[model samples]
Structures are given as structure tokens and as C-alpha cells.
Target: MNIDKNSVVTLHYEMYDANNQLIDKTEEPIAYLHGGYDGIFPLVEEALQGKAKGDVVEVTLTPDDAFGEQDPEMIRIEPLDVFPVEVEVGMMFEADDPETGDVIIYRITDVADGKAVVDGNHPLAGMRLRFKATVDDVRAATQEELAHGHVHGEHGHHH
Candidate 1:
């Protein structure tokens, strides 16, 4: 069936960096609730609209459309003692954003001189991305799936 509002769409996608280097790809077909549910990128959803099984779509996303530009303000240096235990580079911790009270994940990028440098920006932030996807299936979403704003069942969310 053609993809449309409240449809459950299944597809596999490959993501590449601006250099054409492969960044990520789905090993299995994943499903999402279509129609501006935020389950998939808006631009990609737009491209998939009215498409049917076996249709392919390719989209290039700027930093803003993708992970977004890296924010220097998200980086912070804190005393080593502030950490609960020995911290190493690449470790991740969750903390509340002082300004918004939203949870933020901070990754330790450096450890030295009794301090740890943590960055909250997504690793892929500030880079252009190319997404190519092939539609594998499309069907009407179940009432529960639509109400939850996501897909559920095989390759979908489990309650």
C-alpha cells in the first residue's frame, strides 16, 4: 500500500557522511508511524509520502536537519571529585540541564589534571548526512500505535 497518514511504514536506510563514507545502516527493516509523528525525519517522511513498497528515496540533510550543529556551550569541565567514581575518557553520564531541567547525556572526552571534560553534543552533530532508504512495507497503523505516536509489533516498540 502507499505510505500515508497513520500508516505504519517499514524500511531500511543507509546513512553516509559528506565524504561518502558509510556511517550507519539498518541491518533489519524498521517500522515507524508515519505522518508527522516525529518517528522519522520530517524531510525523509515527506520524501516517502505516497510511495509504495519497493520505492526508494534519497535525501541530503544539513546539520540543522540532522543532529544539529555542535554547541560549544554544551561542553563543560568539572573537577574529578564531582564524578561518582574513577572516570575515563569516552564514559557517559546523565545529568539535568541547569537551564531547562531536561536530562542531558554527557560524554567524557578528556581526563587530566584532576578534571574531566564532558561534551553533551551528539557525536554526529555538525556534519552533513545522506540518507537512502528503500520502502519494504506500508500498512494502516493500529489504533494503539496511532494513539501512542509510534509503531508496535515486529521491528517496532514493545510495551
Candidate 2:
């Protein structure tokens, strides 16, 4: 079946950085309720429209279209005592955004001199990405799936 609005699409995808280094790949295919439900990247959804099983698509995304540009302001240096003693580089934790009061995930990038550098930007932020996907199956989405704005069953959301 063609992938269109309300279609349930199953596909395998590989994500690579600008350097062509594989960042992520689906070991098992994934399914999503197609057409603007935000189930996948908008650009990718657009590329998949009208495609059928066995079709392949490759798209290059700029930083803005992918994880977004890195915000220098998002990086802050805080007193080490503010974080757990176990905090170390590469550790991620959630904290409230002082400006918006929304929860923001921050990753520790450095620790020294009683201070820790925490960055709120997504790890992939500021980088271009290449996405490659192969359509494995396509079918009309069930009413329940459409109502939920997502796909259900194997390779999809469980609940």
C-alpha cells in the first residue's frame, strides 16, 4: 500500500553524522502513524509520501532541521555542590529552566575547581545529519491508531 495520511508505515532507518559516522540504526524496523502526527521528522515524512514497500529514501538535514543549532547560552557553569557527588562528565540529569520553569535535561561536560559545566543543548545539536530509510510495509492505520496519533502493535508503541 502507498504511504499516505493515516497510513501505518514500517521501516528501518540509519542515522549518520556529517562525517558519515553511524550514530544510530534500527535493529528492528519501526512503525509510525504517517502524515503530520510528528511520529517522525517532517522532512522524512514528506519524503515517504506515496512510497510503497521496498522503496528507499535518503535525506540530508541541516542543523536547524535536525536537532537544532547549539545554543551557547544553554551551557552553564554551576557550583559542583549543586549536583550529586556522583556527577561526572557525560552524566545527564534534569533540572528546571530558570527562565521558563520547564524541565531541561543537562549533560555534564566538565568538572573542576568546585564547578561543573552543564550543557542543555541536545548532544547532536549543531550538526548536520543524513537519514536513510527503507519502507518495509505500509497499511491503512486503524481507527484506534489514528485516534491515538501513533502506531500500535509490534515495532510500535505498546501503550
Candidate 3:
């Protein structure tokens, strides 16, 4: 069957950055809710439409098509004293917003004697993403799977 809305697709993918550095890869097949669900990116779903099993595709997406452009408001500098003594650059920590209690991930970008710069933007924000995918299987989703809005396997659980 062809990959289309509500179809279950299993594929292996290798993702790269504009610099050609490997970002992520699937050791096994990854499954997702296709056609605008929260599983894969919309652009990728659009690209996979009508494709069949064994098809290999290489697609490049701009920031707008992938993760959105970086937002300057996501960058903030806080006094170094606010963090624990052992805090180091590249460490990710969650901070709660005072008004909403929403947790946000802040990655330490810079550290100095008394201040630190933390950025909350997605690591890939503002960068192009190149995806190399090999479709392993494409089939009609079972009624239960469709109702659950995800895929179920031999283990009898939805992924």
C-alpha cells in the first residue's frame, strides 16, 4: 500500500545538518502518526505521501519547513549564582515560569565568573535538516490502530 493519511509506515532514517554532520538516526524502524498528527513533522509527512515500501528518499527542509527560525526572546542571561555550583556549559535544565508554572528547557551556552547565558531555542532551530529515509513497510492501519491514532505491534501496545 502507498503511504497516505492514517497508513502505518515503518522506516529507517538518518538526519543530517547543513554541515553534513549526523544529527540522529534510527537503529530500528521508527513509526509515527502520519497526516498532521503530532508524530512527525508536517513537511515530512507531505513528502512521504503516495510513496511505497522500499522507496528511498532524500529530502532537505529549510528552517521554516522544519523547526521554525530562532526566536531572540528564547535567549536569556541569568546571574551565575542562580545555578548550582556544578552547573556547566551544555547542561540542560528545566526552569519553571513564575506565572504559568510551565517548565522550559534551558541549555547553558556560556559561563563566566558571575553570569551565564542560557538559550531555550531548539538545538536545530534556524538550521536546515536533511533526511535520508528508507521506507520499510507501508500498510493499512487496523481499526484499533486508527482509532488510537498510532501504531500497534506484536506486543499489543500502541507506540
Candidate 4:
């Protein structure tokens, strides 16, 4: 079946940075609701439209289309007391951007005496991306899945 609005799509993908260095790859197939459900990248969704099982797609995404450009303001050094003692590099937490009041995830980049460096920009931000995917399955989305704006079952959310 063709991937369309309300369709659940299963696919395996590998992502590479602009320099052609592999950054991420799906170990197992992942499923996402097709259409404008925000379940996947808009560009990727557009590329997959009308595709069916076994179809392959390769697309390049600019920083703006993927994770957005990195913002220097998103990096800050906070007082060490603000984070748990166990905090270490790579630990992440949700925080509100003090300037924009928007919620963002902050990853600990450094921990030092009385200070901790956190960055709100996504790790892949500012880099162009290339995606190569092979469609594995396409099926009509369940009513529950549509209502939740996501896919269900294997490679999907549970609970």
C-alpha cells in the first residue's frame, strides 16, 4: 500500500553528516505515522509520500530543515548546585530557556568545581544531514494511533 495520510510506515534508515560521516542508523525498523502528524521530519514525510513497501529514499536536509542552526546563547554555565551531584557529561534534562521561555533539553557538556556547562542546542544542530531509508511496511493507521498522532505496536510507543 502507498504511504499516505494516516498510514503507518516502517522503515530502516541511516543518517550521515555533511562530511559523509555516519552519525546514526536504525538497528531495527522504526515506524511513524505518515502525513502531517509531526511523527517524522517534514521533508522525509514529503519524500515518502506515495511510496510503498520496499521503496528506497535518499534525501538531504539542511540544518534549518533538520535540527535548526546552533545558537551560541543556548550554551551556558550554571552553578554546580543547580544539578544533581551525579550529573556528568551527556546527562540531559528539560529546562526552560530563560530568554525565550521555551522548553528545551539541556545536555551536560562539562562539570567542574562549582560549575556545570549545559547546551540546549541539539547535538546534531548546524549540520546538514543525509538520510537513506528502505521502506519495510505500510499499513493504515489504527484509530487509536491517529488519535495519539503516532504509530503503535512494534517500533512505536507503548503505554
Mark the regions of model 1 whose C-alpha exceeds 4 Å error after superposition: none
Off by over 4 Å in 4: 97-103, 112-114
Between 1 and 3, whose lDDT is larger? 1
Candidate scoring better on TM-score of 2 and 4: 2
TM-score per candidate, chains pooled? 0.95, 0.93, 0.85, 0.89
lDDT of 3 by residue, 1-159 (tens): 899888888888999999999999988788775666667777677789999999887889899988889989889989987777667799999988777888989899998877888998888899999988888888887888878877789322445
Task: Report each candidate's C-alpha RMSD, comma-separated, in the order given.
Answer: 1.1, 1.3, 2.6, 1.9
lDDT of 1: 0.95
Q: List pairs with backbone clashes in candidate 4.
A: none
Query: Model 1 over residues 50-127: C-alpha lDDT tens digits?
Result: 999999999999999889999999999999999889999999999998889999999999999999999999988999
User: Model 2, stretches more than 4 Å misplaced?
Assistant: none
lDDT (Cα) of model 4: 0.92
Off by over 4 Å in 3: 97-102, 153-159
Model 4 Cα lDDT, one tens digit per residue, 22-113: 99999999999998988888999999999999999999999998999999988999998876566889999997767888999999999898
Higher TM-score: candidate 2 or 3?
2
Worst 10 residues of 3 by lDDT: 150-159
lDDT of 1 at 94: 97
